[model samples]
Target: MAIDERSVHGGAALVLRLLVCVVAARAVSAVADGPLLNGNFEDPPNQSQMSGSVVTGEHAVSYWKTSGHIEFICSGQKQGDMVLTVPDGSHALRLGSGASIQQQISLTKGLYYSLTFSASRTCSQNEMLNVTAAPVSGSPAQTGELPTQTVYTSSGWDSYSWAFRAEAGLMSITVTHNCGEEEDPACGPIVDAFAIKTLSQPEASQNNMLRNGDFEEGPYIPPDSQWGVLVPPVDEDDVSPLPGWNIMAYKKSVKYIDSAHFAVPRGARAVELVSGVETALLQEVYTTVEGSWYRLEFSAGDADGCASSYDDGSSSGMKVKAYAGTAETTVDVDFRDAGGSKRGKIEFRATASPTRVVFVSLGYHTKSDNSGTLCGPVVDDVSLVPIPQPYARRLLL
Candidate 1:
């Protein structure tokens, strides 16, 4: 059969058009999955939109809507005797009492997203930030409060993270200052950076029963941050910022440290129980076989970032207590040790379908430089594997 020249040329043109459409779709998806617009608050407002440092217009800040009293702060601006700090960029936003800033974000429905932002207390010791995510399609909102009373880093700034599941294609994120009526109207937290990351739900394999055991999959950490992100305690595991793990302590949080700032025994990240027994990390593995023998292996060590000496000379060591179902063990780490970390193991029998694993610090520790910053043992490289009955009998014999 003879092919017509016009038909052949037309077919080739159609194929080229299809490829262009596919490429365009991928580009749009990439932008949607990336960072938020003007998240670092580096985009300044015009002179008409500002009255001094306070924002006078509602939509003054680019890509955001403001309500009530909102101030645009510079990096080294002084407020009374204290100097304001903006670590993420040259500018930040200060939400006064009853003030809030919100932006509409594009997201994939039903997927979990972790929001990381750099915040610090600027005024009162009880300053707190209330963050909320509400769907545009009339779905329920997810809200959480971040307390900035405790300064984890010497820089007077710390990164905080929270997670929420998207319920619609478009969601609105709002950050408000939670202060009482009698307090000063200028008292609030300074917010410098905002970042969002989609979390991939991890699954267990034969080698490791716990998902995200290595602490590799979690919230986003700023590139310039030396102090680790703080994962606040959540009532439910489904909304946990740290994937597959729940902070089980009331009004406490675990410091998610990175290898760039602290010594990690394994992987690029780990968790530090900074609040002694007040902070607990808990995870439930659903793959556990009932009444089966299993071995729990983990690494517990000091980050070696603490102070060299305390007034009582008793804060030179760290200890972590681990619990697997009903069986438990304690691992002690001396700060003078060379590696700054050590490996530990525990063997236990599964009591139920979902086995509970928990880690908590036994004592309080502070930095050696007299900063009085809270520091504790680092937990990493956790794994749980089933042990054969025959092998268990031989070991016991």
Candidate 2:
């Protein structure tokens, strides 16, 4: 061996130089990854569903995770956007088993951007890799570009992220992965983590916790409405019809295995407003406020979108519970429309009694999912106010 000219310069100076190089490299790497937002994952309120909001049943997912484990794939997606390339490639999450693909974060307003992930067509047909995104509010999303294209080794956690315009109310976000048509098996096309993030919450909203595992935080349908606080959804077998007395509207979220959630009087056709459609509770109410003009409002999003989409999605008469101590129960409607403003609504009336009612619930007309699955509306702002009574003779032909 020969003596090297680039030898240790009195040890200390050499160490200092090496440290400087390491620090520089780290700084550059950090800048390359861009800035990150500090935050915590949460759930919704008042019977709001959480079954599929986050996952980790397998493939390293989130199991009711708050921090550490990211909000990988919200909206009932288990395998998440992180999929196996086929011939055997996977990831490990600190919380769950499968890999995690975090939601596309929205830091500032009006900053458009793109996202990307990694995977290899290294193996054969058994593996498949694809990319997709959730349109923030559970709707159809647009397409963009990817950063580094190919993947076969542990290139570390490097994803493509840029600024974007949060045209939407900035209420929600989503994440999709590279896993589409299974071309073959050996193509071994799959990925573990599509994305990851660190989110930060505002100062005041902390008290307004959205997902404290209780479904209470909300910009809810009835923003001013409060839960029974004393009365909640009775057990599946608990035949507790929402207390009719001292009540205006009682909408509750029913949690079950999937959107196949239904109630007693099956085949009776429940109508309007249902969340976690894959499996949600049945909202049953007593109404018939005609003359006493009553407007029943119901809005549900991402409830039952999978196998159910309303093409001409219209809200019609509701199947309601008729009151007991009332006369001439069939409340008539002079005019009807779901406000045509919000994502959902409906109106009912009772030209006579003040307390008389008609029962109302959700029913599906077209179950073919003309609308996007998971595109259910969140019900809110249900109200009742007396509208001007029209002349009875003018109502009919």
Candidate 3:
């Protein structure tokens, strides 16, 4: 068959598209580093860091749970690009002139590269850490600098993001003192790590059903229990009181799911039904890998109830809904009094195994009655222990 000119061009274009696809796939795989950081340390904690010019604002230690911490240890440290991590009394971390950071991969030409990182300090102070993209080795034409600084206050964990473009190859990402004229020779802001990870081009249509953590709407792990992480409640941030227990309510009574460590992907299995008072339910979602064996253990307390009122302000009981990612899925757990057990047990079950979960939230049901706060199904403990994949043939209830 004789091919027409247009047909020939179309064929060529198709081939080009295929070639581009292959290249893109390869790049994705090369950069697709993940479960990200697992087991390097706490919840995978944070990477390594060094004591640069320490801030006298407060004595906080740089914890290194994992290795390869891209830390700015000292002032005038000529390791990567320029000197960084000098302290400004007013702010906690800032840049010194010529400060930069080297990365593993090369950036595109004239394409703006964005940077984002999470930082936290022991205390809440006026201190700020300046974030900047310093050019390490690249053409000046394409090295459009970004003007923004990341600050780590004496407060909680906060994030800062900025963008910059570069010539082909690599460039140094730096954090330095924002003020150019005045320099604090003795001050260097300690950088936890510099991130070069790029955001997805298009919003990823991820089945990310559940990756890890208790971000869902169930398996609430109460802190005051034995097996509970008690670090904080689900969706609770660092601002939450540390080293304490977060109560999971099921009965209007309070203190449900006490001392529970809701395994990643952990879900509620049962609810205690009572006749006297309103009840509460606690659930948690923990992260886990497929076939990983984990344990969820908890002991419910003597059931209790409370006053309930309707939208009219009448007293009664409320309804409940559970969610993960708040992304809304068919994923919701309902509390049932079907079981004859008075004290409900919140822990592991045999079926409905989850590989990954963001978080588990237990929301109460609001009906015409929204009076007394029901809290119970006391979860004494919870835990998730990863076992070999395929999980045990049967969940050991």
Candidate 4:
């Protein structure tokens, strides 16, 4: 209700108001809670092991099993006495070449769950890790691929997570080190902060088509801002605050604007593709019904605290495109008039298993302040829902 009435006029205004109503009525299931035992590796109850110790089944952390060889790393220990900061806990897990750790959890068939953890390189070189989730109960077993990640932080750590649906009653999660082929085969990946939690059942239109669309999960928020612009290393295609969302900023600044400073139309955060002539944010959404019509609804406007605040005279705009292979929908927006926010939409039929959604800044506006920051389009509250009975619009009325 706290919208800028003047943002859109006449037919456009009416259409947006209806779209917002539809968005609010979408219903989604609730996620169950509780930490998967020793999720933070802060277990063993008051005991911290020194470096260079191997732990396996029965001797490893409670409810965890190991294969090949796994190392026990206590909190405050450096990575092999090197400069790299270790895990933030009383204990963590280390894997060498061919080493792996796994845990099994009881789950309901057809339920969705998310796995999150922290990983860091144990040496000066980069490292890669492979993670998997599969069912053990059903005959023939149902195994699914979870997201695998690489660690290259010279002196820090990074967190990664992914969501998966359970096809059987028991799910086994395994994390393996894939960096043993380097010069020092002993150097591998250090892991900590493990967690497994049930996610709400996904509902299209009622459910969010895009994962982490609100920019809520990602790197820590900086001291002064509500959000942070994620920039990738040179040659890397995607660097984003939210998982599954790729940010394409060729060195230009991007804004992870937060509600702490500006008016967020939906959640606590929004993203602004600032700086470059054409920076983009993109993601692929699964759970689509092939050949079914769907509606994509979202809000777009100018972000605050930048050179081109909404009230400022600078121009801000972007082009939003959604496609499943050949079928696509595109829309353009000019945020100069969007005060609180403006709602926009695109309708299309799914042609593939996953749909690609992209937002790219159309132009580069000059900096409004001393800082050389250009104001760009702000986007948030993106969602996709199936259009019920698209073919049966009217019964001979």
> Could you tell me every candidate's TM-score relative to the true structure?
0.88, 0.23, 0.26, 0.53
Instruction: Highest lDDT: give the candidate number.
Output: 1
Candidate 1's TM-score: 0.88
Candidate 3 segments exceeding 4 Å error:
1-105, 110-112, 120-155, 179-184, 200-397
lDDT per residue as tens, model 4, 293-376: 777777776565333335654444455444433555555655444445677776666778777777766565433443443455
lDDT of candidate 3? 0.30
Angstrom error of the Cα, residue 352, model 2: value is 38
Candidate 2 wrong stretches, greater than 4 Å: 1-196, 201-275, 279-374, 379-397
- Order of the predicted models by lDDT, top scorer first: 1, 4, 3, 2
| Per-residue accuracy of model 1 over 1-397 as CA lDDT, tens digit each | 9999999999999999999887544322222443567888888999899999999998778778889889999989989988998987799998898889888787899999998888888877767788999886697999998877778777888889989999887888889888755268966778878888888888888899898999998888877778888999888734888888999866668998888878999879998888889888999888888878899999988774653455676545778899999999999877663437778888987888788999999888777667767788889999999898898777567
| Worst 10 contiguous positions by lDDT, candidate 2 | 220-229
Which residue ranges in model 4 land beyond 4 Å of their true spot?
1-32, 45-51, 56-58, 84-88, 124-126, 137-155, 205-265, 268-297, 300-356, 360-379, 383-397
Scored by CA lDDT, what does every candidate get?
A: 0.83, 0.27, 0.30, 0.57
| TM accuracy, model 2 | 0.23
List residue ranges in candidate 1 displaced over 4 A. Answer: 1-35, 312-315, 337-339, 394-397
Q: Clash pairs of candidate 1? A: 306-368, 307-367, 307-368
Residue 67 in candidate 1 has what lDDT? 91
Candidate RMSDs in Å, in order, are 8.0, 18.5, 20.4, 19.6
